[model samples]
Structures are given as structure tokens and as C-alpha cells.
Target: MDAPPTEAEVRDRLPAGAAPFAGRRTELAALATAAARTVPGRGRLVVLAGRPGSGRTSLAVQYARSVAADHPDGLLFARMSAPDGSPVPPGRAARRLLEQLDAVPAGLLPADPAAEDPACAALRTALAGRKLLVLLDEVREGAQLLPLLTEEPGCLVLATTAGPLTGIDAIDPVILGGLDQGAAVDLLGELIGGTRISCDPVGAADLAEACTSRPAALRLVAGRLRADARASVTDAAAELAPAVPAAAPQAPKSRGATKPRGRGPAADRRQARELLPAEPVPVADTDPLVAAFGLVYRSLPAPAARMLRMLTLAPTQTADLRTASALVGCPAPEAGTVLEKLAALELLEREPAAADGTERYRVPGRLYPRLVELRSEQDRPAEVELARARLLERLVRLVDSARLLLDRTAGGNPDPLPGPLRLRTPAQAAGWLAEERDQLLDAVRDAIGQGDLDGSAGRLVTALLRALPLTGAAAPADLYQLHELVLRVAERQQAPRRAAAALLNLGDLQAAEGHWPQAEEQYRAALDRARAAGDEPACARALEGTAGCHRALGDPVRAADWYGRALALRQSLGEPRAEARLLVRTAEAHTAQRRFDEAGREYRAAVAVLRRLGEEEAAAALSQALERLRRLVDGEGIVQVSE
Candidate 1:
């Protein structure tokens, strides 16, 4: 392992935002004091609890960068909430942090490593004795932070949450609120231009006040300002201010009211009227952020506004150009321009470019609910369903293309996939899979939720089973779940062939984990379904799976019987590659039973098929195994010549 990053390097590696981090000076001071008061051999945790758009994230990031020198081990950051505002499980967070540290090798982890105790153990081991600064952002609950917490005294954990975190001991809670007027103004100046604020100080102050001094709301206002330079601060302030109804004329107060200037009876009657507003403004329209968003949203070009609304239906909160294009049913370039506009207006956050140079954008947490509302009120149900269908189609095509590039099967060279989604090489395919794993899984759930429209969901699930390897992106547990989900969908759709394929997939995963009995059970079930459906290919695969399971359990006779059935099916199918593979497997079963003559015959038959198929590498490997077997038989002086 390399040495921990130096303080200077940590400073250099801090996350940089488009604008300078503003405000939260008092909050930063409290954090500094908490860090200074840390006891020896005991870590300190500070939870920055606040509502969304309160600048908790900015405060946490700012504090982390400021104290980078104190903790030289390194700085680690993980978001505990997923893009769709759901809590990320602690184990998933740990695995992610472990990946960041590069402390646990990927190959050493099992599929569904999150459920593995070893992952948390590896994380604890990696974090032990290190003076690291760990930032857990958007933590949903106190329990979610426990597994990720380290006992190392030298480290500090700074977490941000939307509400109070319970079930924690001796946690220092720092409440984050809106920024002060000065800081808000400065931030707004930085976003639009300092000259605009400098020209009209009072108007800028009113605008900041109108935003309630919230950073997120201020940024939205700034977006409006940037969009139209000719628009003045007074104009934005007036637009954001809720309209109040003119007060009704009041009758003169009775002279008798002088009896209760301080009495309870008159005061109670007066308070009732005060509680009701003269004008009942729509709560959504009264909200400054909502109003600001409305202003910006209304200003959008028709295509851009429609695209923004449709985005709320995306499988994930984050989207790339390809995803945006699919959602909007537009070409890529047009979608790119719309995305750039949204990012500019602070409606969407522009993430760093992907390895393939594809631009990505994420919806801000505060804005997502509002976007969903807009989508609901404006878009018809049929339009939303159509958009979802388009997205599902695009995802299926991309996954199929990726599967071809990985080429995990015996199928010969892959045919080229058309369009921008094509993955040209295995490395490229793997990278795309890893990067889009979350989106792909979410898309699967989305499709299943949509009732597997036209069986595309089933096709996608099967493709993923073949495309994603067990190593990095797709966990075994996840694959198993996908198989189960697809099986349910197929059974409900009365598609026996699809259900049999899913059963086979499930068996394969179980067999990989050494669960021979469970695997055989699944294979048997699949065999029954395949036979009922008259699906010969599925039946052959199910038989082959059962044979492998029996072979693994040391039952060579049973394994050989099952393999023979599969071999007959493969031969009848006239697929030379499939026949060769089945022959090799049968040879292994015969060898396990010490049937040397039978094994030799099977091996020779496999070599001839492979050679005829122009699979020289496979043929040579089998030939080498046959020669080794011959040498063993010669030593025993029991060699039998078999054709």
C-alpha cells in the first residue's frame, strides 16, 4: 500500500464547485471548536442537521478543506443518500468507501459484498489508526452512520442530515440555517456578476431577503438574473413576492371595545382574524424558491421546458446526454443544448464528464419534488408512459450492445452495434457497466414496475445476466433478485420459455456459489418448464446445469447420465460449438468415474468438433488433456485403444 496522502495533496484534492463556497462562518467556527476539543484516543462526530437548501453540504465541504492539514491520512467523502433521495444502506456505503481507499481488492469480494461481514471488517481495518477526515453527506438516519463510523481517535466524522439523527452517543449537533444577508448578496454577486449588485445595493438586499437568505433559493434567483441581463433586481423581487389581496374596508370599532384593551375575550377574537390571511395565496406560488423556479421554468424554450418536465420520469436523478435524448425523444445534439441551458440556470447540476466524454447532469435535491409536480400537472399519463417506454427501449439496446462487446458466450465475433451507444472494446464495455450500474438496476426496477411492457423487461434482465460479470459492477445477490423478478414477470405474462430462462440464470448463480443442491433444484424446475414449453435449447441448458451440479457433488454416474441427455439434445440441435462444449463436460464426468476408455472417446470427439469449428485453441487444450490421460493409463498398464 502506498503512503497516505500528504496534507498539501489533500488540500489539492478537495472537491471544487463552480462558485466559491460562501457563508456559514459561524457554523465553520463551531466545527473548528469541536475539532479542537477532541479528546485523545477518541474520535469526534459532528452532525450538521438542517433542512434541504440550508447549505449543510457547503459548510461540511468548506470545513473539510479548511482542516485538511490536521488529518493528513486523507479525506474521504461518500453520499449516504442515492440520487433519487433514498437512503443508501450502510454496507453499500462501506463498500464504496473501501473502493475509494483501494484497501480491499475487488476480486476478493463476493457478489453482494454488501451483505458480507468481511466488507465492513475490511473498511474498519483500512480506517484503523488513520487520521482521516470522513464526510458522510445527506445521511438519512443515525443507524445508517453507525457501521461507517470508526473508533480511531485521530479521525473526525462530519455528517450532514436533513433532520435530527437519533440513537447516537455524545454527538455534537450543529444546526445549519440560511446564510446571512451579506454572504447571500456576495454569493448572488459571484453568480450573476458583481457589477449588478454593486450598481443597486438596496435592490440586491431586498432580493436576498426575498429569497429568505437561502443559498439554494439565491442560486435560483441568480439563475434568473443570469438568463436575462436586462432584468433588474427589483423585477425578480417583485415576481417572487407573493401577491396580497387589498384589505376589506373595516367598520369603526365600537367604543365598548375600550373595556378589553388587555382582556382575554377581545384578544382571542382579534387573533382569530389575524390567523387568516386577507388573500389566500397558493402555498406553492408563495414560496420564493418555487416562484423563482416558476420564473426560470416559464422562461425556458418550449423544447427545454418539456424536456425538463419529462426528466422527472427518468430511472435515476442523474442523466447523461444519451439519457436526456431518449427521455425527450430528440436527437443527441438538441438534447445536449437543452441540458447545457438547464445546467446554466442552476436547474440541473453539471457533473464531471464521463470517461467517454459524455456530459452528465444531476437534479438538485431541493428541486426534484417540484420537477415531479410540474411533470404531473403538465404531462399526460400516456405521454409519461410513452417517454418511459422510449427510455426502456434505449436502455435495452445499450445493454445488448455492451453484452456483445464483453462476449462472455461462445458465439463468434460480435457484430457491430449501431449509433452512439456502441461500446467498441471489452475495457470500454466494462467501464460503461460499472459507471451505469446504478442507473441500469434502477431501470430494471422501473421496467418491472411498468409490468414488463412487451416482454422487453424480461429481455433486459436476461441480457444483464449475461453481460455483467460477477466481479465488479453486478453483485450475485443483485443478479439473483433480477432473476427472481424476471421469473415472476414471465409467469404472470404466461411466458414459460422466459420463465425457464430465468430459472436457468438463477441456477447458474447458485451453482457458482457452490450451492449444488439448490442449483440442481432450480435446474430441475427449469427442465420441467422447458419440456412443457417444447423449448429444446432451454432444456439442454437445464440438463447441463444439473449435470454440473451432480459432478460438483462427486456423483460421476448421475453427472454422466445428465450430461448424456444434454449431449443428445445438443447433437440434434446441430450446433458444433454447443456440442463440443457438452462433449468436454461429459469427458470430465467419465474421467471422474475412472472410465478412461469412455473419457478418451469423449475427448477425441470434442477435439474433432472443435477443430472442425476452427476453434484451434480449444482443440489444443483438450488434446493436451487427452495426452496426460494416456500417460496415466500407460503407467497403470491398463490403456485401451478407443475410437
Candidate 2:
């Protein structure tokens, strides 16, 4: 096989250099201090630690440019990580550095370790007395850079990573966070123009927060804003709002929290999330950020690359082993290994175990869209759909099992004996539903949009609806949006019954929030669809919904009329329990209109049905209501009926 591509080949693939580095004053100062302290025969090493897109590479390039004149031997830059996210062999890095410094000719670096070792030694000897600056981008371990360092006091080594490089005695370390607010705003102004900022100072501030002041993110947003003359800072900020969470203040680094070798993958993920926020970074093919990430991503092993792509299917920013396994169709242990490797490469950040002890991992928000774009380009469309289908199927099963457990427990069944459940208990099931609520909602929305609703999408939608009441995780607006999505999907599929159900559900959500007119509109649509489909149950539900809206709007006559229709439907369908419920509602409408005798007759009818159905408690409640109403009608008790 041809000799592995050299580091220069990889370096050639990266973007030209970080674009006019805008911030990182403190980091630059620290580098300046370290450069000043270098002595002859003792070169200095500085490692920059930060998440991808935090501008570590840009800072390195800028620092090198600023100090180039001090080292007349010239500046050398090499990427320590292969495009596939693996560490480039130190010898490969050394050979590339040698070639850059003109100490070795191209294609002369030996492939054999025994020969390469002496070649690297000779190269090091030649560089011992020279002054140079070496910038290593995406360095993983300290060893990768150690071979390329020279003893010459004038030579300086700079490196960057998502975390610290342990086992390397770094002379100085600069931990780069997002740009300071002022620097971030200034950077945006530089890109998009001062007029945009001047027009909407508050929106500009919001944009900064939305980007978490990360330079790479700011650059992308500014690039987009600059391109679209009509796009206001506020509009861009709003577009980015969903991806930006409130920035969690960076925790002070504990002196003792050095990188540990062989830490379990679970521990690694936890540390990763703590160091990097989950805020999304925008990635366009032409974006410098994407170009930079693409360099490392292209270097990842095929398995690791696939894992990274499947990760984009994650419902939330973070995913656990089970989720990963489902997405990739692998065993959990194997999935964990893949995750650990990806985390090592800094493609995925490992987060702390949740309370239930499930290890979690997240693709850096900025990297997620980039990976997704790559996956779309690299993987066939059918393959992507297959992966998504597998994940949705798994989620559907999980939610179905959890709902079963919840229903069984609520029906007076004894507490489930301690055993493994898809979800451990009803309480745990509810919590899981709440946590995955957004993801589930997103899956449904995407499925509908992509026209994949007839398969796992429909099942997922049904499962989510079944679980939502138990979790109480979604708001009324969220519910309405979800049902609206389902309604669209149903209409597309020409499923009239499903369409009617979606409208009814949407109506219920609106009515619950006291939007009576909107609810009535939705209910009427449902009634029309139900009538077309000959779905009597759906018709009864729609009639009941409209009747409830009318009652809430204070139109007692209309409410009573609609309730009468629903009650008649339920009775004709031989649905005694539903009919009983409708009778109670109808009586309430009559009572609101001061028709106590009519209300009493309806109430007695409801009690008879409930008693026949063995609902003693409900029958007793209605019996008491009827007695009170009769007394009021006979004038034994004065009661004012409000309509």
C-alpha cells in the first residue's frame, strides 16, 4: 500500500488559516509571556484547551503571525490529528515538520520505524540551533507533539484541544472560553457592519447571547446576516433562539482535575459536557467552521464517522448508549466503545451520567449540523432513512411498554414487582417521557415534513399522545402544534378518521386554554370530516367538543343543542358510559339556562345509566345533584342560575 498520507497532505486539506482572528486578547497575552520566557536549548510549549469552534486554531495562527518576525527561521504549522479524528503518528508529524523546515526532502521520510527513527533524530539535530514556531492544531496527546519539539530555546510549540493533554508537562496552558461580550459584539460589527448593530443594539446583544459569544458561531451568524440585506439582527437572533440555551457559566477548573488515562467512557462524556456547552454552532459548506471540522471528520475511521452521522438522529442534544445502539443497530457495549473513541477524537462530548446512571453523550451543537450535512453527502438517502426508521421503531416500543406499565399500575394493580421494565416504574416512565418529550415531538414533525408518516412516524405520534398526559411535559401551544402536524400528515395520507381525530385533539387543547372560538372552529372541521368518514365516535367527540366550547362562551342554548346531538350519537352507538357522561354535561347546560326541570330529568337519566354500569360513586354524586336541583326548582332553596 502507498505510504500513509503525510501530515502536510492533511494540513493542505485544512482552511488556509483562521480568518482575521478577532478576539482572545488574554490568550494572546499568555502566549506572548510564554514566548518571552523561552531560553536557548529549552523551547517552550503552550497548549490551548477549548471546544471546537471556540477559535483555538485561529488564536494559534494569529499568535504565530504576530511573533513570526522574532523567529527568522519561519513558522511551521501541522495538524496533529488525522482527518478521521485519529492521532497522526508522531513520526508522521515529525517528518512533515522536517519537510516544512527544509531539513528533509519530500517523499524521503522512511516508512519503516527503524529508519524513520534515525531520520527524525537527524532532523531534530539539524533544528537544535535554529529558531522556529510550530503550531499543532487538534492535538490529542502530548506525545504526538513531543517528537516534533526542538531543544532550541528560540523554538516555540503551540497546541489546541477540546480538553487538556495529560502526560505532557506543559509550560503554560490557556483555557479559551467564548469571546467576552464586548469582543463578540465587536467581531459581529466587523463582519456585518456597524449600522446593523446601531439599528438594533438590543437585538445585537441578544445575538451575542444566542451565539454564546463563540467566535466561530458569531462569524457564521455575521456571514449569514451580511449576505441577507433584509435580515435584521433580531430576525437572525430569533432564528438561532431555539438552539441557544442560557449559557452555563464555565466552572472554575480544579487544579487536581488533570486528564486521567483510561478513564471510563461515561466519565469522559461527563467531563466533556461540563467543559463545553450544548449551544449549536452553525455550519455551512463554505463556512470556515465547516471546512475546519470537515478536515478532522474526513480523517475519522469509517465506523466512527458513521457513529457521528447516526448521532445526528438524536432526539435531543445528548444521547445514551441505548439510543446510540438503536441508531447504529449495534450492541450497547459496542456502541459505548464507539462513543468513547468519538469522545477521544473530540467529535462527541461525553456528559455525566443521569440520575438513573445512564451515561450520556452529545455532539457539540456547532458540529451537529455539520456532521448532518456530511452524512447527507456521504451516505445514500435510503441508508439515512433506514437508520431513522430503526430509531423510531425503538422509541415506539419503549413508549408503548411504558404506557402499558403506567395503565396497569393505575388500574388498582399492585405495585409492579421489582424487575426490569423498558421503563422501571410508572414514575420513572413519566420522567423519561418528560425528558424525551422534545425529541419525540421533533421526530413526529420531521416525519410528517418528510412524508414518512405512514410508517414509524404514525406510531411515534400515537405513542407520544398516549404518554403526554402521564408526563404533563408539553404546553398547550406545543400540543396544538403537534396535533396540527399530525392533522397535516393525516390529510396527506387521505386518512379521514385520523384527520378527524387530530382536529378533535387540537380542539380539546384549544378549549382547555379557553380559546373558545378557535376550539369551536376546529371542532366543526372535525365534525365535517367525521361525517364524511362515517366515524360516529369521532362525530360524538367533535359534537361534545363544540358543545363544551359553547358552554365556556356562555351560549347555553347552542351548548345544549350540541350536547343533545352528542348524547344522541353516544346512545345510538350503545356507548352507555360515554352517554352517561354526555347526559351530565347536557344537564349542566340546561341548568345554566334556568331550565331546572329539564336539567333534573337529564341528571336522573345519567344516574340511571351510571348505576346500570356499576359506577356507584358517580351515580351517588349525580343523585345528590338531582335532589339539590329539585329543591331549588320547587323554591325550597333559592338558587340563582348564571348563563
| After superposition, candidate 2 runs with Cα above 4 Å error | 1-52, 55-291, 404-407, 410-431, 472-479, 576-584, 595-643
lDDT of each: 0.75, 0.69
Candidate 1 has a TM-score of 0.73
Against the hidden reference, what TM-scores do the models get?
0.73, 0.52
Q: Which has the greatest TM-score?
A: 1
RMSD, every candidate, angstroms: 8.7, 26.0
Specify the poorest-scoring 10-residue window by lDDT in model 2: 267-276
- Work out candidate 1's RMSD over C-alphas: 8.7
Error of 1 at 605 (Å): 15
Question: Tens-digit lDDT track for model 2 on 352-374?
Answer: 45545666787665586667766
Best by lDDT: 1
Model 1, residue 240: C-alpha shift (Å): 2.1
- In angstroms, the error of model 2 at 410 is 8.1
